[model samples]
Target: MSLPETMQLSLGPVLFYWTRERYADFYREAADWPVEIVYLGESVCSRRRDMKLDDWLGLGRELTQSGKQVVLSSQTLIESEADLRDLRRLCDNGEFRIEANDQSALQRLSAARLPFVAGAALNLYNPATIAVMARAGMQRWHAPVEMSRNDLARLLADCRSEGLDQPCEVFAHGHLPLAWSSRCFTARHHRKPKDRCQFVCRQHPEGLALRSQESKEVFTLNGIQTLSGACQDLRHEVSDMAGMGVGVARLSPRAEGMAGVVAAFDAARRGELSAPDPLALVEAEICDGYWHARPGMDNSRATTAP
Candidate 1:
């Protein structure tokens, strides 16, 4: 399949807890990456205080000046009053747009009459649901990580039939955020309570790998967010997504080798068929089954770049 000429790459918000310096350094490097859009903010546990809204806004301004479209992302699980306050502040940020990761964010953005990005955690499954969100000021929507390509194509077709024109963004790369909980799994792993847990999530920048009883990799524990054990690489599906009217391909931030991942996807979109597979540069086991409408961890397709 030919590469899509207009398909653009995006940098999703950092789901893991990182030090303030590492966070700044990541965006500093990302500012020059080929991604056209960059989502900024702490969308995970609210205990992650390394980079607050001000710091994210500052980075957004820098990236915006560096020629990248910046979008502030809201937390996925709004558990407390503090989380709600942070969400309000993110919604009130006058400079850049926001990605509504939860219904609280959707309500805040909708009440303010602001156009926002509907995040994958929103669980929008059908054209009717997407149309409802579009009416509520959703300019773009992210397909849930578990959504199959066939389902996505059907949803897009239904949207077209209903005259809905909002752009669709797919989580094309990185560890798929599977679920979120009020309890901090990382803290529990350390035998510590959720409240007094000493910010240990920052220690595992790529998240703590969870293995099965037989010692096979199962999932990753990143504080409150549970992510896929294997990384998801959809470089081969860039053409397929483009054919289905997908406007953006999001690559979640990793602790290392992101520049190469960005370059690989960028090359694929530009018809650089000879580019190497991005999975080769990533540290985790790679899978693309969800894109092929199979189990999320299944990787039956070839891993080579298309």
Candidate 2:
């Protein structure tokens, strides 16, 4: 779909472990896709060192040269001085926008007078919090994964009343990022300690799915990050999001079929296709309950563009 330039289709950072070659190959392929903005980095576990600061910056430059707005994402959980050092380098890179996934990143960026994206992990639950970030030089903010459409509308309205007009980005697709821990669930599943786990996460490019004792899919484990067992497909809410004055719609990078995902969202935005049920594109069940302000795991109801 030929969407207006104001409405951007963005690609979020890869959240799982991948080989360096695979990571580079994915972005090379993405350069030709319909996405307008591309976020680059390892946002999950700091130990996934397949890509480093220089590598991320190099790729970010390449993507920027390819005519895509590139943003560097910080680690969601900072566990050590090394992590903070890496986060400092990302914020100081000065070549691309930085997506501050945690308060540490935000503090660095704010202190440096550098404009950044407030990533979903920053706990931006209300307009007042957003106003503080705006004052701290947040150019755009990604709404928390659990925030509903009405929640977003209300926040936007409240911010507008305060004359705070920072752009809002939504996590429109991908497994919902639920929580982060000091421990690695993936390693625990394999009976290995996080520091000595031998990089088992490389095997589960899409993440290791965890099921309940009842044999129901429950959650996905990617190193220290826990995600929704169901993939979030808000393709159906494109029109509603656009109407709500959303500036960017982010699609998280998966190991496979990302081209099709980008094409699907591009087409859906152009009115060429109904946002296909997100479930149709992946092996996991689809969920949009959080968009309706319901339980994050509830998929019993959804609302699409009229």
Candidate 3:
């Protein structure tokens, strides 16, 4: 099948804690990457204040000047009044669009009548839910991480029947975010309370890997967010997603080798099958079972060299 000419690549927001300088350098280099869109801001935990709202807006402006579309993302878990205030500030930033990661963000943005990009954490499942979000001024949305390709195709078909045209973006690559908790898993791992974590998450930029009794990697602990142990690679399915009317492919940020990930996806979109395999550039095992309607950890398809 022919790839959709309009399908674009997006860099998802940074999900792990990093030093302020490291965050700045990442975006500075990402400006030259192949992605057309970039989501900025700390989306995982509220205690991660390395970069504040003004800092994020400043970075967004820089990226915008570099010819990339930037969207300010809201925190996924709103546990405090401080978090609410941050969300309000993000919604009123007046510069870049917002990516609503939770219900609070959606409410604030909708109340202000501003259009937003719905984050995957919103858990939008069917066309009926998407129609409601569309009416609430959602201009784009990320498919839930567990949504199968067949489910997405069916959802898109239903949206078309209802005349809902908001663009759908898939979490095409990176560690799949599985859950968020009020307690800080990283802090607990360090034998500290959530309030006294002392910012230990910074030590593990990619996240603390969790393993099962059999010593198999299972999940990753990043502050309050739980992520998949194996990186989810969907480069092989980009053409199928394009054919299903997906408008954007989102790659979650990793601590290293992001340039290769962007290049590999770009090559896939352009049908350059000879590009270097993105799987080779990452440290974790790769999986695509969720995309194929199987267990999330299963890699149903055999790996093929690109």
Best by lDDT: 3
Model 3 weakest 10-residue run by lDDT: 273-282
Q: What is the C-alpha RMSD of each candidate to the true structure, in Å?
A: 2.0, 2.3, 1.8
Model 1 spans > 4 angstroms off: 275-279, 302-306
* Residues 1-306 of candidate 3: C-alpha lDDT, one tens digit per residue: 347778999999999999999999999999999899999999998888878888998999999999999999899989989999888988998989999999999999999999999999899998889989999999999999999999999999989999998999999989999999998989999999999999999999999999999887899899999999888999878888888899999999999999998998898898885644444447887888899998888765445453
- How far in Å is the alpha carbon of 182 misplaced in model 2? 0.5
Regarding lDDT, does 1 or 2 come out ahead?
1
How many clashes would you count in candidate 3?
Answer: 0
Please, what is the whole-model Cα lDDT of each candidate in the order they appear? 0.89, 0.87, 0.90
| Poorest 10 consecutive residues by lDDT, candidate 1 | 272-281
Candidate 2 per-residue lDDT over residues 26-59, each given as its tens digit: 9999999999999999898888887888899899
In terms of TM-score, the best-performing candidate is: 3
Query: Relative to the unseen true structure, what is the C-alpha lDDT of residue 193 in candidate 2, on a scale of 0 to 100?
Result: 95
Candidate 2 at residue 68, lDDT? 93
Off by over 4 Å in 2: 1-4, 275-279, 300-306
lDDT of 1 by residue, 218-294 (tens): 89999999999988988877877888899999999999999999998887787775744444558888888888888
Please report how far candidate 2 places residue 86 from its true position, in Å: 1.3
Give the candidate order by descending lDDT.
3, 1, 2
TM-score-wise, the better of 1 and 2 is 1
